[model samples]
Target: MATIKDVARVAKVSVGTVSRVLNGSSKISPESYKAVHDAARQLGYRRNAVAQALVSKTSKMFGVLVSDVGVPFFGEMVKGIEEVARQKGLHLLICNGYHDATEEKNMIEYLLSHRCQSLVVHSKGLSDEELIQYSREIPGMIVINRYIDAIKERCVFLNNHQGMHIAVSRLLDSHNGVAYIGSSEDIQDATDRYLGYQKALEDRSIEFNEQWVVHCEPVAEAGYKAIKQLAEQGELPSSIVTYNDALASGVLDYLHGEGIKIPEQVSVVGFDDIELARYLYPKLTTVRYPIREMAEFAANLSIQLLEDATPSVSDEELEFVPKLIERNSAVI
Candidate 1:
């Protein structure tokens, strides 16, 4: 029930000075700010956020729109973003698009309309033009994991090329040959990873085998079916590298059911070291993506953009190289 006027009177400052301190304007003197805060705390003063937002045009909330919240990769990134947002005294408004392009577009528009301070998005099907238009309007938005050339400065992604190179290198050296499973080759990440695999094989003077590449949805069921098809054809490779832990788990489950030994019969490696990787029957060897780092960086960058920090928008898109996480699934 205590008001700003009461705090100002107690702190021996004008209401405007008290307002500056509460709003984090950074223009108030330190002594005045401390006194104002003390008075507010003593009086149990609470801010009317709805009224403040109407007056100042700021909600102090950030919107996070993800393509698939069910994915472990996105979940880890959200954890990192949320941590940073909490430190900055900002609230997160999460929206899950469930891999639906229409839902993603609608969510983006809705967040902006609600005066979200900024937005961090992980999209699977948004077009480059749509992204650019969205950024042009809000201007403090960031797209995670996927790259849009038109909105280059607004995107942050993983170093998939290097990750695939590392994965393929281990497979080639440790086994005579390897196969790829999960996702269609048309997808940008899948294509880049496939190219990296080809490049590594070429570097080692190993012939590229197109037959070894299996394209499907990036899901456990897809991976299971891919392997089952290979088994039926009697075309199993000596080793396999998967798009993510989901696919790897599927492969492990399928192979185990068939009484096929892992690493001894066929080594398996995966990308994205999900939490389940370490808990699997045979711990998975995978890529340790800097998801938390990337998420926090993106969140902070969005805040910088919101604050009109000129150089924040000047920086190019950033990518973090994933390191291999060795475990029982792949030979050291």
Candidate 2:
């Protein structure tokens, strides 16, 4: 209930002095700082972040936009971002856009309206032009897990094509029959991964067989059903490359139920080596997405972009490569 006026009156200092002290301005004298602190503590005064931002044109807040916070992948990403936030004495205002364009736009506007100068966005719903425009407006804005050619310097993302290609290529080393379980989601990641699968086959001079590939929802049940359909058709491939670990988990379950020995019979490779991949029956061979490291870099870069005129890495240094994690599930 206490205000700046009350603190100033009790501290016996002008309102500007109290304001400077509260705002961490170095111009304030030690005497004024001590007085303001004592008076504010006596009155149990809390600084209003919004009001302070209105005056200072910024705040100690980083706005994060993700598809869904409940998802484990995003949770780890948030953990990384929060780590950096805590180190800098900053707070996070996170919002879920649910992969909806309108919702994504709304969440972004809401963060901006709250005077969030530093923003980290994981937007799969918005167009490149829209995101590029937003990056121009918010100098501290950085895109995560997605890329835009115009704002390549502002993006921290993994190469889905390269990751899938690496997984598929690794499988091709010992197995000729490769299947793909693609995400039905209409995102660039899915498209690039699917393309990566096909490219890997082409580079090996193997004839393409569209029959072994299935596009379904990127979930465990969907992955299970996808493989079931493939099995019912005639036969499954010698090796399978999935959109993500969740799909791979389902594939493992189905294969286990069918008495198919993993690696011995059919090898499986998954993308985004999430924690779940480690605990699976035969473990999992996966591409490490490195989301945690990517997120930490993004949050740190957001701060740098806000504070420094030069920023860091003016080129395409934001791109991250995925490392293939070989576990028990895949052979050779």
Candidate 3:
């Protein structure tokens, strides 16, 4: 509960002297520095970042808005940002929106209320116009996993359409019949991925079947249910592509329960090469999303806008591409 005044009083110095020493001013005498240091240690006085920011007229915090902090995918995202924050002696103000629009807006406002000048946002609910307005208001805001041409310079996103095209094309090379388990989420990512799947098949002159596709929540349970749905409709397709690794995991479980041999009787391809993909029985064949690296790039970009000169980043640099990781889960 010790303040600057308390440190000054304990050190027998003026509050200004204490401030100078704590702020690492070269003007402070060695005796004053030692006195302040000794007094701070004795009183356990810690410098408050907020109070310091008020005097400096700049923020010492980086705010990150994510869909859910509990998700392992976002967990890696936080870690990536933390690596940058630690290097710059900055603290992170993390807030979760739980993929809700109202909550997402509230979290961004809360970060702004705390005077966070630099932000790395992963928003699924806010519209492009709303976010564009926010980008105008906050020069250091960087959007991840989404793109807006108005604020393209501040966006760090993945090429979901291209990624899905590559994945589906790979699957089609081996099998004529391919099924898709896509996300029911109303996000652009879901739409882009689905379109990518369709476009790949169309390029090969394959007929699209409504029965071969199932849209569900991007979770393991949904994956399981989607696979079960496919099974009940008639028969499971020889090759299946999923929206994400979580759903693909469920498909694997369902197939295993049915005593179906993988990559022989059936093949599964998943997106987002999450860590769990490796541990699952018969390791997953997935597309590497590189979320952590993308987050790290976004954090560095945000800091550059706030701390130093903004780096000249091109659209290609900001846009990431996914790579298909061949594993035991899939084959011809």
Candidate 4:
């Protein structure tokens, strides 16, 4: 109910002086600042964020778009972005695209309509051309988990190929029969990871078989179904590489129900070192995606691009390599 004018009257100072103190402008005297603060506290006065944004022509807010907020993967990414945004005195406006192209475009447009100057996007459905146009339109937009050559400087992504390669290589070292359980999504990540698995097989002179590969939704239930399908065909491999930790956990559950011992009869390696991976029976061995670090970097870069005329992107920050985490699930 209290306004700046009320605070000014209570403090016995001019409204301009109160404004300067509230804005933290160095031009105001300390006495005026103290008096304004004391009066504001006594009157329970709060600064208007929308009014401040209108005056500055920029909101003190950051926007983020992820595939699914309910998933732990996106949850971690959001946490990282929130951490950096809070430190910079900004709040987050989050949207979920649900891996749909139209939904992604709509969500992005909604964020822009809100006058959010800084944005971090994780898009799997939009084409490179569409994303490129968006990057040009929004100078502070940063892409995560995907690479576009036209906006290479604004992309923060992991090396999906290398991550899969390392996972497959680990399995090939000890197991003669290896299978790959991958996501059915038509995203670049799914393609790149499958290619990495194939390349690893070629490097070891192991023949590639289509039957050894299965594609399904990137979730625990789909993983369980895929493993069951493999078993029905009597083509289950001695070792398996999964698209992510959730799928891998499903595979473990299915194997346990079937009375198959992990790392004894079959070994499994997963991508994304999510927290659940460590707590699973026999602990899943996985590749660390470093999503939290990447999300924080993307949020920072988005803010920098908005504040600076020329923003710089380091190679190390743009291309993050996945690290292999050894655990009790796999052998050799």
Clashes of each: 0, 0, 0, 0
33, model 1: CA deviation in Å?
A: 45
State, as a TM-score between 0 and 1, how close model 3 is to the true structure: 0.83
Q: Per-residue alpha-carbon lDDT of model 1 for 61-143, expressed as tens digits?
A: 88899866778888998998999899988888888876567898878766755667668988776777877877776656888
* TM-score of every model versus the real structure: 0.79, 0.83, 0.83, 0.82
The number of the candidate with the highest lDDT is 3
Give me the runs in candidate 1 sitting further than 4 Å from their true place. 1-58, 312-317
lDDT of 4 by residue, 13-119 (tens): 99999988877799988889899999998996766443344468768778899999999999999999999999999889999998899999988877875667788
User: Residue-wise lDDT of candidate 2 within 216-286, one digit each (tens)?
Assistant: 99999999999999999987878998999999999999999999999899999999989899999899989
lDDT of each: 0.81, 0.89, 0.90, 0.89
Q: How many clashes would you count in candidate 4?
A: 0
Clashing pairs in 4: none
Model 2 ranges off by over 4 Å: 1-58, 314-316
Predicted candidate 3 versus true structure: per-residue lDDT over 1-332, tens digit per residue: 68899999989999999999977799998899999999988996756443345457777788999998887889989999999988988889999987788899889877876777678999999989989988876767899999999889999999999999999999998998789999999999899999999999999999999999999999999999999999999977799999999999999999999999998999999998989999998999999999999999999999787655467898889999899999999984
